[model samples]
Target: MTDAAPAIAAAGLRKSFGALEATRAVSLAVPPGGRHAIIGPNGAGKTTLFNLLSGALRPDQGQVLLGGVDVTREGPDGRARRGLARSFQRNSLFAEMTVAAALMTASAIADGGSAVFWRRFDRDAARAEAAAAIAARVGLADRLEELSGNLAYGAQRQLEIGLALATRPAVLLLDEPTAGMSPEETRAMQDLLAGLPRAITILVIEHDMDVVFDLAERVTVLDYGAVLLEGTPAEIRSSDLVRRRYLGERTQ
Candidate 1:
């Protein structure tokens, strides 16, 4: 594990949609290269919190810190430039484009080159370099010609992650990456996520406790938009509050 300071920090974060409060002065930190999990019930403000982190939605108060910089007011692109990136749960991708094309597009953005438009991909050396590296890293090398939409659901999710990785983000925020996946696919995703380069930090919000405990070095439990408890997997599994509030006890 990396010993550097947190790659991302949310201090006293708050958000609201009119009278409904989505996030209630929440604060959390993911140390550099840490495998952190944000576990919460539905509507516990997980998605809302993700929006705040990625600059998709501005917070009502507090600040977001990335690489020890206060970027509370920066927009999405600005955050991306600072090595902050994210992947959506809803499968964000270009359905019509082949995997190679999609990856090459990411390569363009990463290499800071012009995007391909109405032309075949012949030899954008820089983009090809980045695309080939990312595709190989994500195990999509063979599926390069497959259209994104034509791939299996798990493959689509893999592409989504591959896109995020193209930026070479120092910290990656994943919003329920395992949602709708079968057991086999879920395990595969877990393995892929776990094997990520140690230089990249990961903060994930997931429902599968097994996956959470398996991947996260530390876990934070939230209920009603407030943090309930935080600790290692062993500590959280034995916490009374976690058992009562989040994991219902099995009746005798």
Candidate 2:
């Protein structure tokens, strides 16, 4: 990809289930190393758009470009291998596995070591070190031996993000990273995300205005399956149209 190309871009994406169009001509471009956010109400096609971008679902009509390469037909794994990773809104983890084990598994899988099932993960020095680094990066180093299912809700969220980071993605799609977090947890998550390396572009779908406003360099407001506004946080916050159509006075 050239320097001018966006890390993630969607063009004229459209998806429908029978008569209900989930996404309507939605298009966006996230610059390399940029932090962007997508926000809308419950049925505003936010997650649907993520699905299309992340290769969870194919768009009926559109193109998805990853690092300037057309990947509309790529599957999730293919896209992931091509430097795109995602964390779901809900935790996706091995509940019974220790945090260290789960991160090791993620790293091993990313390294195409899935067939080495007979060997203990801790025996692989490379993978172990990688896993430990990821754990520290996500602030879970203290809980390495703890079961993933037993982690506090926020820590589980952190582990989920760690799983995504194991792949060393160029673009990370975070779907409500702060969901279900207490105020303290939310603040911690915000700090963790803000500290991520600027080389990794981030696209977040969030309902929490505080997180969105604080972390996003630019905001895309989706409403009725289309972009209603795309601007800096200050501009979005001040847009009378966005306030009337979505943000409302409460978000202001």
Cα shift from native, residue 1, model 1 (Å):
17
Clashing pairs in 2: none
For residues 1-252, write the lDDT of model 1, one tens digit per residue.
Answer: 956567999988899999988899989899888999998889999988888999999999989999779999899889989999897332334677777777776655655655555134436667667777777776687888888889898878888898888778899999999899999889878888877898999999999888899999999887888788989999999998898888773322
**TM-score of decoy 2:** 0.94
Pairs with backbone N, CA or C atoms under 3 Å apart (clashes), candidate 1: none
lDDT of 2 by residue, 1-252 (tens): 636799999999999989999999999999999999999888999999999999999999999999899999999989988899997333444676788878887777777777246147667888878888988888898899998989999999999999888878899999889888999999989988988898899999998899999999999999989898999999999998989988884653
Task: Report how far residue 154 has shifted in candidate 2, in Å.
Answer: 0.6
Which candidate leads in lDDT?
Answer: 2
Model 1 reaches what TM-score against the true structure? 0.91
- Model 1 bad stretches (over 4 Å): 1-3, 88-93, 111-122, 249-252
Cα deviation at 18, candidate 1, in Å, is 1.3
Highest TM-score against the true fold, candidate: 2
lDDT of each: 0.83, 0.88
- Give the per-residue Cα lDDT of candidate 1 at 167: 70
